[model samples]
Target: MIAAGTASMGRAATPGPSRWPRAIVRLRLALRSSEAAARGGGGGRWAACFRPAPVAGAAAAAVKEAKGERSAEVEVEPARGGGEDVWSARADAEVAQGGGFPEHLVVMVNGLVGSADDWKFAAEQFVRRMPDKVIVHRSQCNSATQTFDGVDLMGERLANEVLSVVKQRSGVKKISFVAHSLGGLVARYAIGRLYEPNNRRASSAGKSRDDVEHLEGLIAGLEPMNFITFASPHLGSSGNKQARFLLLFYEHMTFKSLPFLCGLPFLERRASETAHLIVGRTGKHLFLTDNDDGRRPLLLRMVDDSGDLQFRSALRSFKRRVAYANANFDHMVGWRTSSIRRQHELPKHRLLVRDEKYPHIVYVEKEVTNNRDTEARADLYDPEEEMIRGLTQVPWERVDVSFQKSTQRLVAHNTIQVKSYWLNSDGADVINHMMDHFIV
Candidate 1:
């Protein structure tokens, strides 16, 4: 017993130094485990604070690499109204594109029951692709149910919102609009309100043709550039006879817009009668049923310059006007209305080609019309015909998109804009096409 006790004491005294190293190692491993657990949200609240923060540049690069996007670093700041502005740093933009920081303001408007988030993908793509030439602002003023308001009220709201944005960003010298669905109509109405002739009449008394063209003036005192719409009902949402006949047999249809009624005669007629009950004043406007104040429908009045609202002139001020329409499966908006064409004007299906770069872009047509040929016809009683004639006065580049072969064809309206990246990734090419062809 005495020998055993003495041996234990001897060993305890001699190996104390070695034992200390083992103890320290055990402690370190315990701490690491706790840290890992805390990171995984298992336990140990304070362990997260011990971790080092990732370097900003490295983190951003990692994200870009993971997403396979070569987009430059951008900053997003809250702007007036419910919108947010996206722009890259001047140094980064110049380094990436060898150009000055963007001076153009691109307003992105959302559609029915939509918010600023609807344009998130497109807005980001715009800033990423044209970092040196454009700042994208996603509009949120007339979002969600607010879109149910009549076009005039929404237009006024949008105009005020835009003016607020302009006042906040005095550095912006150019303006453009990118809208979807109902937002297109809202944008049109807003521009009409924002248009200033620069005393065009006073300056045109003795000016040359060239000089008069130059005096076309500005939108909100800023030079207008591209005005683009995606799946917008430019000719209103009333269904045409051809579309109704084609969709007459589809029984499992959903309520999207007027055209989504599957072209059934009874459904279309019933929808026209009760559209206002569902979407409020905006529905009335879309169906051409709003005859408030004993006047023609608001959509009809918007086709021409009425009183101070120079609707056509405002459109003419822009350098480019584009309409992106879904040829099929966009039940929400009819191709004819979205494309601003008559039944006979639609391009043949055989003409559609799949470009390697833009697989979904089926066709593109640029319509050029002489000013004399597009003079507003006041005598025309057919509202749809009048609108088609009125808007075609300014040349439009119509881009036809078809998801006819895609798994996501059913939601072509949302897909065309990549409204939600994960769900609508198939529409990415359309956005890429827009970015590739976008004018600075």
Candidate 2:
């Protein structure tokens, strides 16, 4: 799942003298300086980095006005040979003057060990396909070595990155998230944080319930649109016996006891005691065994309703919630986990027949299990159903995509993104169709 690192965010303050030696701090600062120079000193702030011009003619004028710019009226050109541009059709519908076409911002988050660069092709395609209607931003704040941090910590950083962008762009009135693999969990936690009321005291103002509500309302006003993920272990890896075993192995080898003896020297950095620290914590969380605080699993807390009004409000505000799972060749995440469904709920087959309309995709509707049914099986706890019962109450549409071994050699975990060769071959259109639900 490791990909090239994109530009890093501003480094956090160095540890105190007791935590780090001056020599190491200096070396780290130098390395960061060179990395910034290579990335063209992009200022390490969350900004709208892509704004492709709208299609030629009247649409151009609309785009300018959409940006709050006044311009002379331009005659719209008729479709040549009575053919419309496929890409232009994907843009937002036109609006009358002063009606104001609210711009939608799509935030794409990469999985563990992945970077913003991984979304380069996907972002470009979205811009090229949707033009002025949508803007895509890739978050690389918690990638690479940084991914070794816990999900809650990463989620806090991502929340800041998103809030920074939202603060900078006043025109953006709606937001959507497209995350992959572990990024989905991070995004979930971040959104929960965003929904919560701001507790920081306002300058020259007293803290009150009204002020807190207003702060939360500001985020809610953004109009969360779509929450989508690809190959995300929503039910987590601990739901199954096999997955649990593998997670146990991974935890012991990386973070539990003998990570150094795992023979993965490349994962160790002198500045950071173990490069695997972040991954180990992440694994433990996913395995539902990282109860350091004596609380429930992180995933459970994420879906719980009591005392999480903000989280429930955020979840209810989203217009759509969807997940894409791989039917085969996805050894990292299983179908049930990625789909957030119970094993007994899905078909007993390895692969279903290809979908007719979306030949590359298979759609699975969530099985609604009645609470009474759960009462009879009290011995077993259905995490999937429990999540649905939570305040978030997500109604997920699980899509399963096929991966042919004869055509592709590697697993499908990483290929869910748009840039994958497998997706580019014939699956791009299908993926685009899936994304259409969020375009408007």
Query: Where does the lowest 10-residue lDDT sum fall in candidate 1?
Result: 248-257
lDDT of 2 by residue, 341-416 (tens): 6557665565476666666675555423223334537687765566645622546667777665323213255555
lDDT of each: 0.72, 0.54
With a 3 Å backbone cut-off (N, CA, C), the pairs that clash in candidate 2 are: 148-278, 149-278
Candidate 1, 1-440: lDDT as tens digits: 32343243235334455554553344344446444664575535433322223346644553342234634466778987658988766635475676555779999998877788888777776776676788888898997667768789999998998999888977677899999988999999999999878675333233344644564667877778889999888888775533232221121122221123332355466667655545567878987889999998999989888889989899988888999999998867789999998787899999999888899999999755534444446776667877888888889999999998775575577789877553455787898888777777
The number of the candidate with the highest TM-score is 1
Residue pairs in candidate 1 whose N, alpha carbon or C atoms collide under 3 angstroms: 244-263
Off by over 4 Å in 1: 1-72, 90-101, 200-215, 241-267, 370-381
Whole-model alpha-carbon lDDT for candidate 2: 0.54
